[model samples]
Target: MLKFLPGILLLQVITVVLVLIAPTELSGWGWLRLVIPVGIVGVLTAAWFSSMAAHHNKDEISRLQECHAKEREALRVNAERAKHRVIKQAHQETIQEVRRTSTQANIKVGMAFAGAAGIGGLLLLTQFITLGLLMLTTAGGALGGYVLRIRQEKAKMELLPKTKTKPRLINASPTTK
Candidate 1:
């Protein structure tokens, strides 16, 4: 904005000097003709300044709109992320609850089996049979845990929505009408 002021002032000063340095023959109405050049220069100078100002204004507006659009997009993404986080947390909580319940049930069943094995070993009075029964009970408990894990995974899969494929259209026709 400040760079053009010196040039504008210099042009005005040159016009004034030319107007003053004319002979009387060339000075009368001919001197007045100098005003034409001055007017032309003035008009051109005004147009240059006006165009610069208008361009500056347009650039500023474009920058402002760009900033606003970026902010809006950021806000929208943040909102979507927060919503997804909440849903994920809920799903995690449900999984945790299922794990807890399954663990408790497994413990109860394992204890019952162990107690039954202990009573049967006492009736048979054999240490080898008691150890074998204990091993079998542990293996069964492990298998039950694995099955529970599979059930939990199946439940989680069921909770998810199914994906649907969109149909694609293909046409071999040209657009000439």
Candidate 2:
């Protein structure tokens, strides 16, 4: 009704002008005489229906807006969940990498110890050095291997990206509403 006000006013103005200009022109009841009344009624009815349709359309538009808002909120929630999942996965990967690195370090240390023991045994059997020298060399080799293993482990750890020990705050709440 409100939207059709302008159209109604325009129609009224045109009707008044036509009536004033042709007072006796539309007085006859021939087929041509029916045209003016029919046309005027058709225009008015079309304007009324168009206004009603516009109201219905506005209602539908509001409903669609609400649906769109809900969909946007759902997408936001899903995005947040995905972000948290990625952080968790990264943390797990970091833990696995650290464990793998530690295991390799232990294996290297074991191999170094075994090789040093084999060398000391060979030296003792061949009498390459006195018993005291053999003991000193074995002790020195064992100590050196232990220190080298520690250094290697430190280097390997340093090569890896450090993982955050504490859980991170991914999203902070807004101070203003």
What would you estimate as the lDDT of candidate 1?
0.73
lDDT of 1 at 23: 51
Worst 10 residues of 2 by lDDT: 163-172
lDDT of 2 by residue, 26-131 (tens): 5446545556765876677687778788888999999999999888877777777778788889978998998898789779877876676677777777886676
lDDT score for residue 133 of model 2: 60
Index of the highest-TM-score prediction: 2
Model 1: how large is the Cα RMSD against the reference? 10.4
Name the TM-score of candidate 2. 0.53
Error of 2 at 69 (Å): 2.7
Q: Taking the tens digit of each residue's C-alpha lDDT, what string does model 1 give over 1-177?
A: 785787688777877776777555765588567777777878888888888889889999999999998888777667766766777789789989988997898788777766765665664565667666666676567667867886898898899897543322233255797
